[model samples]
Target: MINEVTRALVAHLHSRTPDLGSWVVVHSLSAADAAPAKDKLALCLLAVDEHDHLRNSPPVEVAGRLQRAPMQLRLSYLVTYFGPHDEAMARLTRVIAVFHTTPVLGQDELPLTLGEQVERVTVRLRNTTADERNQVWSVLGRPGRLALFYTVDVAPVRLLPGLDGDGRVLAHRIDLAGTP
Candidate 1:
């Protein structure tokens, strides 16, 4: 589900800025370690944090059956521009500008899987402390490089199908006469 969102963003970026079509790449942080080519930029999904807004929500009704609500997830990504120091920074700047303009992605912009279930997704810049940023690179066993942190929120990832049960109110008795 999350992969689709990432791919959609990459596609959108490519469409908006045709120049970056071949230069932009999306992959996981671990994957990036395997291929450290300095020519292409990468958007790495570093982590995912689940949101608590609907964490405890009860099962929702779907087609008259009770189905579990999908957990909302916040995807963290590290956008790294690779190449000469100045050139990399320049590409990074362009990446930031693109995100700044399109902070939110509507359903039409998402993949069919996400578009059908999620209403919208939000992309925001995450400011990380030096220590925190260093920790991420350390975990990957790679030296720190120029990168920007971003968080993408995806809601209701419904993985389970609706359970078979009767949820409809068959009848209701009125006690307007002050009787229990």
Candidate 2:
């Protein structure tokens, strides 16, 4: 199931941008009794579009931080879904990031059944071409229909820039309360 969703999303993104790269992520959702991060994730989509209001945008560059607020604004559309397969869900949910953008990764811990895991998946994408950045901004900023789906319950996954002292990639842990 995870692979299927990942493949579908990759395909969709690739279809839109042929020259993009992506990374797969798996999350745990046992601690979270319910999904709370969904709101934040959904809000991000909206932020992306609303933040800058799309002035003369530029193509995506391989090395650069995207205007974070705008991307976050664009992400706000995911709050309405509680399951996968919803139209909005398909467009908003991300288990992998394929484009070229610096990803902001973090997590919180949650209490749950003995060994159950509840998690949220987030993928950040940026345009690799100088022109694509502006084009992506335009696409994300505008109001239109997007695909989305209900997320699966699993371990929370985080994307970090490098590894930590523990020899693990420095990723945040998201729990029921929040990121910790």
Candidate 3:
């Protein structure tokens, strides 16, 4: 579900910014050592936290079984550009514009892989200080790169059920160190 949110963001960006082409990627700034040095944009999921207010939401009913409530996640991302500084900054402007216009993404706008529980996700540009950004860089053990912090809030995470459609328990595998 987390990755699906990222993919949805990337897909939305690509759909909105045609000139960006296929350069947008899900990457870590620290892993660019061996990658090609072409002009591209990188989206790094810096942190994922549960939405505090909705953490204890009610359970769900699916196929006559009571399932635990969906876990709502807030996904934080850092968008970075690698290559020519000037053009990269211009692209950042476009990104900001896109998000500014459509901060809320409906289920229809997102990837089809999203579960039934996720109705929508909110995107917000977080106001971050240089010190906070630097702390993130410090935690990554890498130098700070130019980045914008965006958070996608309320992405629902629904766990799969143990029983199959036919009311049978799914297979399980347990590996133990010692013989039974």
Q: Relative to the true structure, how large is the alpha-carbon lDDT of every model?
A: 0.79, 0.31, 0.80
- Lowest lDDT 10-residue stretch of candidate 1: 160-169
Ranking by lDDT: 3, 1, 2
Candidate 3 lDDT over 1-180, as tens digits, reads 777888888988999998768878888666434443468888888889999898887766777766667688999999978777897788788889999999999988877766355888899999999899999888766767777899889667777668432232357889879977
**Number of clashes found in candidate 2:** 74
Cα deviation of 135, candidate 1, in Å? 0.2
lDDT: which candidate is best? 3
Instruction: Assess candidate 3 and give its lDDT.
Output: 0.80
lDDT of 2 by residue, 1-180 (tens): 233323433444444445323322122222232432432222222222322343333322223532211121223222222234463354343423322231321123222221132233244433245454344336545322232222222232222333331132347987686676
TM-score of each: 0.81, 0.17, 0.79
In angstroms, give how far residue 144 of model 1 lies from its true place. 0.4
For model 1, the superposed segments whose C-alpha errors exceed 4 Å read 162-180
Worst 10 residues of 2 by lDDT: 68-77
Clashing pairs in 1: none
Where is model 2 more than 4 Å wrong at Cα?
A: 1-115, 118-128, 141-180
- Looking at candidate 3, the ten consecutive residues that score lowest on lDDT are 161-170
